[model samples]
Target: METTQPSGTTKRRVELRITRPTLTWFARPTVTIDGVGHPAQWGTGTWAVPDEGGTRIGVYLYNRVWRFGTATRTVTAADVSLVYRSGPLPVGAGRLDAA
Candidate 1:
Protein backbone atom coordinates (compact mmCIF):
# COMPACT_ATOMS: atom_id res chain seq x y z
CA MET A 1 0.00 0.00 0.00
CA GLU A 2 0.98 3.61 -0.57
CA THR A 3 -0.03 7.06 0.49
CA THR A 4 0.74 10.61 -0.49
CA GLN A 5 3.29 12.30 1.76
CA PRO A 6 2.89 15.82 3.09
CA SER A 7 5.78 16.81 0.90
CA GLY A 8 3.95 15.42 -2.13
CA THR A 9 6.25 12.37 -2.14
CA THR A 10 4.97 8.79 -2.09
CA LYS A 11 5.19 6.65 1.04
CA ARG A 12 4.81 2.88 1.16
CA ARG A 13 4.61 0.41 4.01
CA VAL A 14 5.30 -3.34 3.97
CA GLU A 15 5.01 -5.92 6.74
CA LEU A 16 7.03 -9.15 6.62
CA ARG A 17 7.26 -11.99 9.17
CA ILE A 18 10.22 -14.37 8.96
CA THR A 19 9.00 -17.23 11.15
CA ARG A 20 11.08 -19.90 9.36
CA PRO A 21 13.87 -21.39 11.45
CA THR A 22 15.93 -21.70 8.29
CA LEU A 23 16.01 -17.91 8.19
CA THR A 24 17.24 -16.47 11.47
CA TRP A 25 20.99 -15.89 11.28
CA PHE A 26 23.82 -13.64 10.03
CA ALA A 27 21.23 -10.91 10.22
CA ARG A 28 18.70 -10.61 7.39
CA PRO A 29 19.41 -11.41 3.75
CA THR A 30 19.40 -8.78 1.04
CA VAL A 31 17.28 -8.57 -2.08
CA THR A 32 17.27 -6.02 -4.89
CA ILE A 33 14.55 -3.44 -4.98
CA ASP A 34 14.73 -0.97 -7.86
CA GLY A 35 18.27 -2.17 -8.43
CA VAL A 36 19.08 -1.77 -4.76
CA GLY A 37 19.93 -4.38 -2.13
CA HIS A 38 17.44 -4.53 0.73
CA PRO A 39 17.57 -6.62 3.90
CA ALA A 40 14.26 -8.41 4.42
CA GLN A 41 14.65 -11.64 6.42
CA TRP A 42 17.12 -13.83 8.35
CA GLY A 43 18.15 -17.49 9.15
CA THR A 44 20.23 -19.59 11.53
CA GLY A 45 22.92 -22.24 11.07
CA THR A 46 21.55 -25.42 9.49
CA TRP A 47 24.37 -27.90 10.25
CA ALA A 48 25.17 -28.61 13.89
CA VAL A 49 28.71 -29.75 14.61
CA PRO A 50 29.09 -33.46 15.48
CA ASP A 51 30.31 -34.07 19.01
CA GLU A 52 31.47 -37.58 18.10
CA GLY A 53 34.69 -36.52 16.37
CA GLY A 54 37.58 -34.57 17.86
CA THR A 55 37.51 -31.21 16.02
CA ARG A 56 37.80 -30.66 12.24
CA ILE A 57 36.27 -34.03 11.40
CA GLY A 58 33.41 -33.46 13.82
CA VAL A 59 32.22 -30.44 11.85
CA TYR A 60 31.29 -32.69 8.92
CA LEU A 61 28.12 -33.84 10.68
CA TYR A 62 25.15 -31.74 9.64
CA ASN A 63 21.38 -31.72 10.12
CA ARG A 64 18.24 -29.96 8.88
CA VAL A 65 15.82 -28.09 11.11
CA TRP A 66 12.21 -29.20 11.33
CA ARG A 67 9.40 -27.09 10.00
CA PHE A 68 5.79 -26.51 11.10
CA GLY A 69 4.56 -24.68 8.02
CA THR A 70 5.53 -23.14 4.66
CA ALA A 71 4.95 -19.75 3.05
CA THR A 72 6.15 -17.14 0.46
CA ARG A 73 5.93 -13.35 0.00
CA THR A 74 6.42 -10.69 -2.66
CA VAL A 75 5.94 -6.99 -3.43
CA THR A 76 6.20 -6.54 -7.18
CA ALA A 77 4.27 -3.35 -7.55
CA ALA A 78 6.14 -2.30 -10.70
CA ASP A 79 9.32 -2.54 -8.58
CA VAL A 80 9.98 -6.32 -8.78
CA SER A 81 10.82 -6.36 -5.07
CA LEU A 82 10.45 -9.76 -3.40
CA VAL A 83 10.88 -9.87 0.40
CA TYR A 84 11.06 -13.69 0.39
CA ARG A 85 8.54 -15.05 2.92
CA SER A 86 9.60 -18.03 5.10
CA GLY A 87 11.71 -21.18 4.48
CA PRO A 88 14.63 -19.08 3.26
CA LEU A 89 17.32 -21.75 2.99
CA PRO A 90 19.80 -22.66 5.73
CA VAL A 91 22.65 -20.46 6.95
CA GLY A 92 26.40 -21.38 6.73
CA ALA A 93 25.65 -23.83 3.89
CA GLY A 94 25.23 -23.28 0.15
CA ARG A 95 21.54 -22.67 0.85
CA LEU A 96 21.43 -18.97 0.06
CA ASP A 97 20.39 -17.99 -3.48
CA ALA A 98 20.14 -21.39 -5.22
CA ALA A 99 20.63 -24.76 -3.58
Candidate 2:
Protein backbone atom coordinates (compact mmCIF):
# COMPACT_ATOMS: atom_id res chain seq x y z
CA MET A 1 0.00 0.00 0.00
CA GLU A 2 1.07 3.55 -0.68
CA THR A 3 0.56 6.59 1.51
CA THR A 4 0.22 10.07 0.14
CA GLN A 5 0.80 13.27 2.02
CA PRO A 6 -0.81 16.61 1.49
CA SER A 7 1.00 19.33 -0.38
CA GLY A 8 3.64 21.33 1.53
CA THR A 9 3.90 18.63 4.17
CA THR A 10 7.44 18.32 5.44
CA LYS A 11 8.91 14.85 5.64
CA ARG A 12 11.84 13.66 7.70
CA ARG A 13 13.64 10.38 8.19
CA VAL A 14 13.34 8.34 11.37
CA GLU A 15 15.29 5.26 12.33
CA LEU A 16 13.77 2.30 14.18
CA ARG A 17 15.92 -0.26 15.93
CA ILE A 18 14.82 -3.63 17.27
CA THR A 19 16.82 -5.61 19.78
CA ARG A 20 16.50 -8.91 21.63
CA PRO A 21 17.23 -9.55 25.28
CA THR A 22 20.25 -11.62 26.17
CA LEU A 23 19.54 -15.37 26.10
CA THR A 24 16.37 -14.76 24.14
CA TRP A 25 15.44 -16.71 21.09
CA PHE A 26 15.41 -15.52 17.54
CA ALA A 27 13.05 -12.76 16.55
CA ARG A 28 12.00 -11.39 13.22
CA PRO A 29 11.28 -7.69 13.23
CA THR A 30 8.70 -5.87 11.16
CA VAL A 31 7.92 -2.19 10.97
CA THR A 32 4.43 -0.85 10.46
CA ILE A 33 4.06 2.57 8.93
CA ASP A 34 0.59 3.96 9.19
CA GLY A 35 -0.63 0.42 9.84
CA VAL A 36 1.19 -1.07 6.84
CA GLY A 37 3.64 -3.79 7.75
CA HIS A 38 7.14 -3.62 6.31
CA PRO A 39 9.54 -6.49 6.94
CA ALA A 40 12.76 -5.09 8.39
CA GLN A 41 15.53 -7.67 8.27
CA TRP A 42 18.00 -5.26 9.81
CA GLY A 43 16.43 -1.94 10.71
CA THR A 44 13.89 0.48 9.26
CA GLY A 45 14.42 4.02 8.07
CA THR A 46 11.38 5.83 6.76
CA TRP A 47 10.04 9.27 6.06
CA ALA A 48 7.38 10.77 8.25
CA VAL A 49 5.79 14.08 9.10
CA PRO A 50 5.00 14.66 12.76
CA ASP A 51 2.11 16.99 12.11
CA GLU A 52 0.37 14.50 9.90
CA GLY A 53 -1.63 12.01 11.93
CA GLY A 54 -0.94 9.41 9.25
CA THR A 55 2.59 9.07 10.61
CA ARG A 56 1.84 6.40 13.16
CA ILE A 57 4.82 4.06 13.18
CA GLY A 58 5.31 0.79 15.04
CA VAL A 59 7.72 -2.09 15.37
CA TYR A 60 6.61 -5.67 15.73
CA LEU A 61 8.74 -8.57 16.83
CA TYR A 62 7.68 -12.09 16.01
CA ASN A 63 9.08 -15.28 17.46
CA ARG A 64 8.23 -18.96 17.72
CA VAL A 65 7.26 -18.68 21.36
CA TRP A 66 4.94 -15.77 20.83
CA ARG A 67 3.20 -17.05 17.76
CA PHE A 68 0.86 -14.56 16.16
CA GLY A 69 2.13 -12.02 18.67
CA THR A 70 3.85 -8.73 18.05
CA ALA A 71 5.15 -5.80 20.02
CA THR A 72 3.80 -2.51 18.71
CA ARG A 73 4.51 1.15 19.50
CA THR A 74 3.96 4.55 17.97
CA VAL A 75 6.62 7.02 16.97
CA THR A 76 6.04 10.71 16.31
CA ALA A 77 9.30 12.40 15.59
CA ALA A 78 12.04 12.87 13.03
CA ASP A 79 15.79 12.23 13.29
CA VAL A 80 14.96 10.11 16.31
CA SER A 81 15.69 6.47 16.95
CA LEU A 82 13.17 4.16 18.64
CA VAL A 83 14.14 0.90 20.21
CA TYR A 84 12.08 -2.18 21.06
CA ARG A 85 12.81 -5.44 22.85
CA SER A 86 11.68 -8.98 22.02
CA GLY A 87 11.62 -12.13 24.03
CA PRO A 88 9.55 -15.16 25.03
CA LEU A 89 7.64 -13.40 27.78
CA PRO A 90 7.96 -10.85 30.60
CA VAL A 91 10.15 -8.97 28.18
CA GLY A 92 8.18 -7.06 25.58
CA ALA A 93 5.16 -9.40 25.73
CA GLY A 94 3.71 -7.94 22.58
CA ARG A 95 4.28 -4.41 23.81
CA LEU A 96 6.90 -1.92 22.73
CA ASP A 97 9.08 -0.13 25.25
CA ALA A 98 11.33 2.84 24.67
CA ALA A 99 14.96 2.20 25.33
User: Quick one: best TM-score, which candidate?
Assistant: 2
After best superposition, candidate 1 residue 49: deviation in angstroms? Answer: 42
Error in Å for residue 24 of model 1: 5.4
- What TM-score, computed on C-alpha atoms, does each candidate reach? 0.29, 0.56
- In the range 1-99, model 1's lDDT, one tens digit per residue, is 565335423344333323344444333334332333344434322222222322111111013433212222223333211222334444332221111
Residue lDDT tens for model 2, 18-78: 6654544576667777787777765444445455443666666667766333665555543
Residue pairs with colliding backbones in model 1 are 23-42, 23-43, 24-42, 24-43, 24-44, 25-43
Task: Give the runs in model 2 whose Cα sits over 4 Å from its true position.
Answer: 1-10, 23-26, 43-54, 63-69, 88-99
Per-residue error (Å), model 1, residue 10: 1.9
The list of candidate 1 runs beyond 4 A from truth reads: 1-8, 23-27, 40-83, 86-99
Cα deviation in Å at residue 49, candidate 2?
A: 5.6
The Cα error of candidate 1 at residue 20, in Å, is: 4.1
